[model samples]
Target: MVLGWRRRKNNNHKGVKQNVEVIVPNHFMCPISLDLMKDPVTLSTGITYDRQNVEKWFDEGNCTCPVTYQIVRNLDMTPNHSLRILTQDWCVENKQHGVERIPTPRIPVSRFDVAELLIQVKASARGLDQYGCLELVHKMKRLGNEMERNKRCIVENGAPGALASAFDAFANDSIERNVNVLEEILSALNWMFPLKLEAHKYLGSKASLTCMVWFLKQQGLSGKEKSIVTLKELLSFGDEKHVEALSEIEGVCELLVEFINKRISPTITKASMRVVWYLVSSSSPCSDKMKLAFVELDLVSSLLDILIESEKSLCEKALAIFESLCSIEQGREKGYSNYLTVPLLVKKILRVSALTTEYCISSIWKMCKLGEKDDEKRVIVEAFHVGAFQKILLVLQVGCGDKIKEKATELLKLMNPYRAHLECIDSDYKNLKRSF
Candidate 1:
């Protein structure tokens, strides 16, 4: 796109030398982009394009050629050497015109090369050779993340199992108990985690989840974030038995709570919150174990802290964890104790997104139900004092979704006569109050 010429003084005192500007020819350009091709590759459809552009088209899951619109009966692209040679020759000829020959691009990786890498990675895992295990993993991670084809090639060639075994072996053999090498291996696996087939394979064979739990406990800050990411992916792809087992891991829940309480990166906090949510997804004992784990770790305070401070997206995640924990008595106790709990829900009502508002009210219902059920007016009294009643009245007026509105309305009915004794700020709710 940059095309210009300049004048330079002649060595022999000739007035000046003209650097002529040249225009790149249309035919010399890629058909798909109309830009001059570096590493021109001819498709099975007989159209030549820059290798990167053509590969991108196919990587987006296309089988037809872009220029001809022909079905690539076979997905093959041949290097258009003649076109490249002519283009390079033109650049050389036009050197005085500010034309620089494009350097030859590196050849794209072949599946054969990927398969060879897996062999070496597997051998390293088996202790056949270990000199460059970290380097090999780095190479595989870069190539795999480069494109869908490379990722598919690596995962399809048993790289996942190799990675899991390498991690387990490293964890077992650490003399200094160092996790630096482990961090590099995990960064690769973390990128395309939750691979369903690999999940079943490693979760069943290597006791990978337990290994991850250990890593979470042992790793430094960087490693801890990566570990949480890996564990969440593992739990997401794991089966019923895997969840049953993970729910029972002694410190897993506490570790997640710690991540939340420490206010680690939002990525880590949300990921940890998700794993806790999954553990509590199942019924009693399994669910109960995770619930107590949250309360025992003082998770309610952490959840409330994040719920108000974070971005809307993350606030929703924190609220989701609160929703699950609030179902248990211990969860309710923690929610009731936190000064921010009732008032936070009060503030979020009709104030945040529809989903957050739903979680907010649900937590309130669970906590305030203690008041509703035990005829204990203390919570109802506190909610009224905290402006929770005003927000609930506002929920009745706004279009906060059916279930949330209904819950808010019913909560009002339950506290019918008292009406929390607070002024309804929203005019719409004042009119709606007659119906309530």
Candidate 2:
């Protein structure tokens, strides 16, 4: 009876195997790539599978035949013998054809994007294992380099959308949590593409600027040290391409001046003053946007104030701005003269001589030229003091030449109503001649 039972079971198994072979197809193919399965791997979506990753698919409960899209049960693996033969044949054909199947490369993320990612990792660091957080931070640094490279490409191409997208990703990904990371990104961006038009576009866009300001505040950059650093970065390139964008940002110049005052460091103050000087000196027309920087930030007064307190180099820069303001025809057309007093400015000019004899002398000479009218002449006369006269005479005595001496004598005569000053100047001239 036992022998009879064993024979019946064997017959049943044979019948099941025959049925499985009849049902299963010999070959399977992927619809998308239209290639025989190399390593049939299942995707998280459950709909896609690669023949090359068949074992992985089965491990993940996705033991489905790629050709028929039928789920093959793990326990009934024996049923798919025909499919296996077909996969082996396909692999051999693929090797013969030299059809190399490479995985798609990931799109390189920007430094801005990596910064955003680092911010997220930093926020969650407390919860993550220390080693994991460290690893993420390291990954973020690598991503930052990729971002810098992409930004360089965008800058060269003049692609605002690419820059905007990069900034947007950064804003959405990282600016909210680790504000310092955003700062690092901004610093990097500022350094990499200091004059990129796309950066200006991003800065001008209300959304981007607002987000940046928010990030700045969060990073404790709202103060003068940070603000000045930011502005210096903006104006560092000193390129004509950046001028329009620099003018576009409302109150940037004034904010920069205010920052300089607050920060009060010689280096920072010097750099900030230089940027303002560059803007005024550049031939580009100052826009209402740029004028707004003066109006809102009281930049003129701030500049005058800086002239009062800053170091020699900073003072020279401020004086250059003054000189440009006085000389540019637009100053009168733009009614800048109406807003600022030449006489008060002249007094400030005289004060600069005490700071640097050469600078003050040069400034006075320029101021005298600006004094074209009688009223302007009278103002110059009243403002000029004996100290200024002595400096002018000293310059003349040192043999500044006939033209300078003539100008100085004329200026001196205007200042000295009585002829008593002439005796001192005549003495200095004789003394200089005697020495020579």
Q: Per-residue CA lDDT of candidate 1, range 1-436, in tens?
A: 5533343535567666655456777667887777778989888777889987887888789888886788887766788888888989988987865678987765666767877887787677667334467779889877866666678667766777777777666656661343555677777777656556654555433445666677788767777788778777766763656677787677777787887777658778778888877777655357787778778877777777776556887788888888888777888877766666766776776666878888888877777665345533556655666666667777677667787777788777656667545543322221111110
Q: Candidate 1: lDDT of 300?
A: 76
Identify the runs in model 1 with alpha carbons over 4 angstroms from their true place: 1-21, 59-61, 127-132, 142-158, 165-181, 203-206, 283-285, 370-372, 375-377, 384-402, 420-436
Provide the RMSD of all predictions against the true structure, rounded to 1 decimal: 6.2, 22.1
Give the backbone clash total of model 2: 13
**Model 1 lowest lDDT segment of ten:** 427-436
Best by lDDT: 1
Residues 1-436 of candidate 2: C-alpha lDDT, one tens digit per residue: 0110011122465554221111112235444454444434444334333433453445566555654666565322112334445656544545433433433323544445645654555444434233444454445445445544444433444332233334444555554654444444354444344545555554444444545545434345333344345445555555554566555655556555665566546655666666666666666677333444444454545555555446667666766555455453333222233323333344343344443334344444555555456544644554453244555556666655465466667766766664454232211111111110
Best by TM-score: 1
lDDT of each: 0.71, 0.47
TM-score of 2: 0.43
Residues forming the 10-long window of minimal summed lDDT in candidate 2 = 1-10
